[model samples]
Structures are given as structure tokens and as C-alpha cells.
Target: MKIEVITLNAADTLQAQEFGADRVELVSAMNEGGLTPSYGTLKNVLQSVTIPVQVMVRPHSFGFVYDEKDWNTIKEDISIIQELGGNRIVFGAVTKDGEIDEQLLEKVIHHAPNIDISFHRAFDQVKSQTNAYKVLTKYKDNVKRILTSGGKDRADQAMDELRSLVQLSHELDGPSILVGSGVSPDNLATLHEHIGASEYHIGSGVRVNKDFNQLLDKSKINQARDILK
Candidate 1:
């Protein structure tokens, strides 16, 4: 099993690495969900740590329904990150009716062939997760994984649904199901056991400072990492 911590910004990079997290989902502003971090932040993470860093490609905190300009920004950011040697990227796009915007997502994938792409929790925003999961499975050859809370507010609260979705992901031969949102040391082990998940995502729960991105309290992440083990 792998323990992944969500690094809301650069500050958490060093501590996350020290805490022995398998990977870090680099992003910005968890207060309004999460937005894309700046180029400098990404570069710093790339330089500061040896662990894998998956940069978030979201342009803003608004829903995953992006506009034309937002698509352009995502494409451009993908190019920049790839050029800078980012290991992976996380992002998502949805239609007005709340379906995965395959067209837009495909374009980004086309540009980022060498990088892993995790469809962020925006997967929960879709009108129908079952239908959306079907569509995502079709792109399994392209998408690397799905970060979801099973259409609920938090992973623990949504464990049953997450278990079903995990089963569905396996049935469809899609990418991994990375449970996220409100996950913490307290309930992660139980959730992982309940869902039989190998990967987990955490955010505010591990933060030890006022700034969301500042260095994680190694004790907090380590405490959870030990529990997961």
C-alpha cells in the first residue's frame, strides 16, 4: 500500500518527504477546494524532494467546468510542467450537464503523453458517477487514476459508496481509485481496510501550520503513515 499526502503548496514539500509519504499532490488554496500552484512552487518541489510530485493543473477553484481560456491555460501549464520535469499532473474537466468533458481532457492528455494524470475529486461533481466512471474507463489508456470521495463529503462518510466505486473501477479495468477529501490519520486505516484501497489522499488533516502549504508536521503525517502500515 502507498500513502500519498496532498501538498496544498510548497511549504509542505520538505515535511511531506521527511514523513515518508510515497507521493505528493501539489496544489494551491484548499480553502476553495484547490487551484493550480504557480510555476515557482512546482519548480521548488521538483528541486526540494526526491519523492514523486504530482502537480495540480487546475486554473481556478471554480467547478471543473472550465471555459475556453481555462482549457488553453491547462494545456499551457501541462507543457510547462512537462518541460520542467514534473512527474505527474492532476486535473479534470466537466460539461454543463456535469459529464466528463472528454474532448478537453483528451487534448491535455495528448500534450502530456509522458506524464501521469489523476482525475481530481472533481469526479464527484459529475451528475452520475456510474455513467462518468464508464466514460473514464473508456479512457483508461490515457487517464492514470481517479481521485474521488464517492460523491460524498468525505472518504469515511462515503466508504460504502467508495467500496462500490473501487469494485467498479476494477470491473471496468480502469485506473486506480484514490480516495480523497477529509481523510485523516484517525480514520484512514479503517477506510483503507473497508475499501481495500492501496492508495490514500490527505489534506488539511496533516497540515500543522496556519498556511495550507507550509511544511507538514512530520509527526502528523508520520503518525498516519505508521497507522497505515
Candidate 2:
């Protein structure tokens, strides 16, 4: 199994790497549900580790629905990150009516043609997950993965839906889904068994005791890694 860690800064990236995480989902203001990291933060994180970094392109935490200017800013951010050698881009977009905004998504995905992309949990906002999967499946080639909590607070609570999504996605050649939200060592095995997922994402559970301003906790990372093993 592969483990991915959600990180808010360069320090977290370094720590995640040392902890045996395969990738780091880079973001800022994680306390507010994450936003795009500053250019300097992106640059610093790129220099800090060899593990893949998936930067969040969210402008704020309140909602996934975005306006014209917000869309433009997202495109701009993608270009800047690509120029600075960013590994991957993580983001989400929804309409005011709670549907996937395919029109805007096509543009943003086009802007970052060379970078790997993952649709964030905004997938949860779609009113109907079955239809939502179809909408997202349309971009399977452009998107590398989808980060979701199974439309609930944590993986365990939504395992049935997650498993079904995983099954349905594979049936349609849709983007791979990386279970997230409340994933941790304690429930990793159960989740893996339920979803048959090779990849997973974690944030709060791992960072619960972390000091983002300093280096990551190597010991805690080892513990998490050992559990995954």
C-alpha cells in the first residue's frame, strides 16, 4: 500500500518524507480547510524533498463554487507552479447548484497539461455521486486521482460508498480515488480491506501533535509507517 500525507508547509513535507509517506498534499491554512500555498512556500517545498508534492489550488475553505476571477486565479496559479517545477496540482470546482463545473475544469486542467492533477473532496459537494462520477469520468485522462472522504466525515463511515465508487470508477476507467479525511493507522487496514485501495491520504490524524513551524515528527511517522506495513 502507498501512503500520502497532507501537509501545510515545507517542514511537513520533509517530515512526511522521513516518515515513509509516498507523497505530500501541499496546502496552506489547513485549519481553514486548506488553500493555495504561497509561491515562496511552493518554491521552498520543492527544494525540501524528493517525494511528490501535490499542491492545493483552493482559494478559500468556505465552498468549492468559484467565480470568474477565482477561475482565472486558479489557472494563473497552475502556470506559476508548473514553471517552478511543482510535481502535481490538487484542486476542486463545483457549480452554485452543487454540480461539477466541467466547463471551468476543462480550462484549468488544460492550463496544467504537463502536471499531474487530482480533483479534491469538492467531489463530495455534488448532489448525486453517481452522476458526479460520470461527470468526473469524462476527465479521467486529464485527472490522475480524486481525493475523497466518501462523502462523509471519515473513511470508515463511508466505506460502503467509497468501495462502490472505487468499483464503479474502475468500471468506467475513471480517475483513481485516494480515500482521505479521517484516515489513520488505526483504521488503515479496515479501510484498505473495504476499498481495496493501494493509495490513501491523511492529514489531521497524522498532524495532530505536529509543530508545523518545526521539522516533522520522524518517530510518529515511523509509527504510522509501521502500522501501514
Candidate 3:
């Protein structure tokens, strides 16, 4: 299994590396779930970490439904990311009625043809998980993974749905399901056993004080890494 740690700054990025993280998802405004890191922050983080860093390209904290201006900002961010040697991007968009925004998604993919893309937790808001999976599968070549909690607040709480998604992922040769949200050292073993997902994402679960504002806890990250291993 690959351990993808979410880092808010250069310090957290270094901590992720020291603690044996396989990948780092870089973002700012983590309190708002995660907004795009500033260009300077992105540059410093890219220079600081050797591990693959997937930059979050979210324009706002609210919802995934974006307008023309929002899409333009996302494109600009992608350009900056690519220029700075960041080859992986995490983003997602959905229609008002709760479906994958295919038109916008394709445009983003077109903006960065060479980089790997992971649709973020916006997948959790879709009205039908299976239907959403089908829509995402159509762009499997471009979207390598989807970070989701199975349309629920936490992965463990949606084990059955996750299992079904994992099964479908294999069947369709679709995007791999990277489970996140509330994954922790306590339930890591159980989630691994039940979901059998190959990739996992952790944020507050790896913090020292269990607080998003605090820096990542190396002990907590190492503990989770050990469990996953």
C-alpha cells in the first residue's frame, strides 16, 4: 500500500519524508478542507521534498461546482504547477445536480496532459456512487485515482460502499480508489482488512494534537506507516 500524507507547508513536507511517506499531497487552508498552496509555497515545498508531491488545485472551500472564473484560476494554477516541476495534481468538479462535471474535467485534463490527476473528495457528493464511477472511468487514462470516503464522512463508516467501488475499479480498469477522511492509526488495520484499498490518504489523523492547525506528528505518521506495511 502507498501512504500519501497531506502536508500544509515545507515543515510538514519534511516531516512526511522523515516518517516514510510514499507521497505528499500539498495544500493550504487545510481548515477549509484544502485550498491551493501559493506559488511561493509550492516552489519551496517542491525544492524541500524529494517524494512525489501532488498539488491541490481547489479554488474555494465551499463546493466543487465552479464557474468560468473558477475554471480559469484552476488552469492558471495547473500552468504554474507544471512550470515548477510538479507533475501530479489533485482536483475535482461536480454539476449542481451532483454529478461529475465532465466538460470542466476534460478541460483541466487538456490543460495538463502530461501530469497525473486524482479527482478529490468531490466524488463523495455525487448522488449515485456507481454512476459517478462510470463517468470517471471514461477518463481512466487521464485520471489515475479518486480520493473518496465512499460518499460518506469517513472511510470506515462506508466500508461496504468502498468494497463495491474497489471491486468495480478492478473490473473497469478504472481509477484506483484512494481512501481518505478519518483514516487513523486506530482503525488503519481494520480499514485495510475490509476495504483492501492499495492507497490511503491521511490528514488530521496524523497530527500530533489531532488538530489540523498543529504540525504533523512523526510518531503518528510512522505508526500508521508501520501498520500499513
Candidate 4:
């Protein structure tokens, strides 16, 4: 199994790599559900971490619906990431009616042709995950994966939905599904056993005191790593 840790800064990035994270999702403003990190921070993290770094390209945090300026900002961020040698990018967009914004997604995918794109948790906001999965399948070649909690607040509460999504992904041979939101070491093994998902994304779960403001807890990360083993 692969563990992707969300890091808010350079220090967190280094700690995540040292504590055995397979990959790092670089972002800022966790309070706002993560915005794009500063260029300086992105450069520092890219230089400091040897492990794969997936930069979050979100322009704002209120919702997934983006405007023209937001899309422009996202494109700029993607260009910055590409120039900084970051290969993986995480982002998503949806319509007001709760569906994938195909037009915007195509623009995003076109802008970052050299990078692997992971549709972030915005998948959970869609009206129907089943329908969302079908929509994402159309862009399977450009979208590498989808990070979701099965359209629920917590993945554990929606295991059946997650399992179904996993099965669907396998059947289509499309994008991989990365389970996140409320995943912790305590239930990591259970989720793995039940959902059979190989990729897990953690943000606050591995933090000190489980607080995003604090540094990542090495012990917590080790515990999760041990369980994965």
C-alpha cells in the first residue's frame, strides 16, 4: 500500500518523507481545505524531498466551482509546478448542479500535459459518485486517480460505497481510487481489509495531537506504516 501525506510547509514535507510517507501532497491553508502553496514554499519542498511530491492546485477553498479568474490562477499554479519539476498535481472542478465540469477539466488536463493529475476530494461533492465515476472514466488517460471518501464525510461510514467504487474502477481499468478523510492508524488495517484500496491519503490523521497546526507525528506515521506492512 502507498501512503500519501499532506504537508503544509517545507518542514512538514521533510518530516513526512523522513517518517516514511511514500508521497507528499503539498498545499497551504488547511483551514480552507488547502490552497495552492507559495512558489517559494513549493521550490523549497521540491528541493528538500526526494520522494514524489503532488502539489495541490486549488485556487480557493469555499467550493469546487471555479470562475474565470480562479481557472486562470489554477493554470498559473500548474505552470509553476511544472517549472519547479513537480510531476504530480491534484485538483478538481464541478458544476453548480453537482457534476464534473468537463469543459474546465479538459482545460486543466490540457494545461498540464506532462503531469499526472489526481482529481481531489471534489469527487465527494458530486450528486452521485456512480455518475461521477462514469464521467471521470472519459478522461482516464489524463486523470491518474481520484481522491474521495465515497461521497460521505468519513470513508469508514461509507465503506460499501467505497468498495463499490473500487470495484467499478477495476472493471473499467480506469483511474485509481485513493481513499482519504477520517482515515487513521486505528482503522487503517480495517479499511484496507474491507475496501481493498492500495492507496491511502492522510492529512490531519498523522499530525501531532491530530491537529493540522502541529507538526506531523512520526510515531503516528510509523504506526500507520507498520499497519500497512
Error at 196, model 4, angstroms: 0.8
The numbered model that scores best in TM-score is 3
**1-229: candidate 4 lDDT, tens digit per residue:** 8999999888899999888999988889888888899999999999888999989999887799999999899888899888888878898999999999999999988887667888999999999998999999999887878999998899999898999999999999889999999999888999988998879999889988889988899999999999888
Clashing pairs in 4: none
Q: lDDT by residue for model 1 over 1-229, one digit each (tens)?
A: 7778888555577778877889888887778777788888877778788888888888887778888898889888888887787758888889998999998888876777666888888899999998999898877876778999999988888899899888988888888899888888778778888998768888877777524645577777887778777
Looking at model 4, report the run of 10 residues with the lowest lDDT sum: 108-117
Q: How much is the lDDT of residue 140 in candidate 3? A: 86
lDDT score at residue 167, model 1, on the 0-100 scale: 93
Ranking by lDDT: 3, 4, 1, 2
Model 2: worst 10 consecutive residues (lDDT sum) = 208-217
TM-score of 3: 0.97
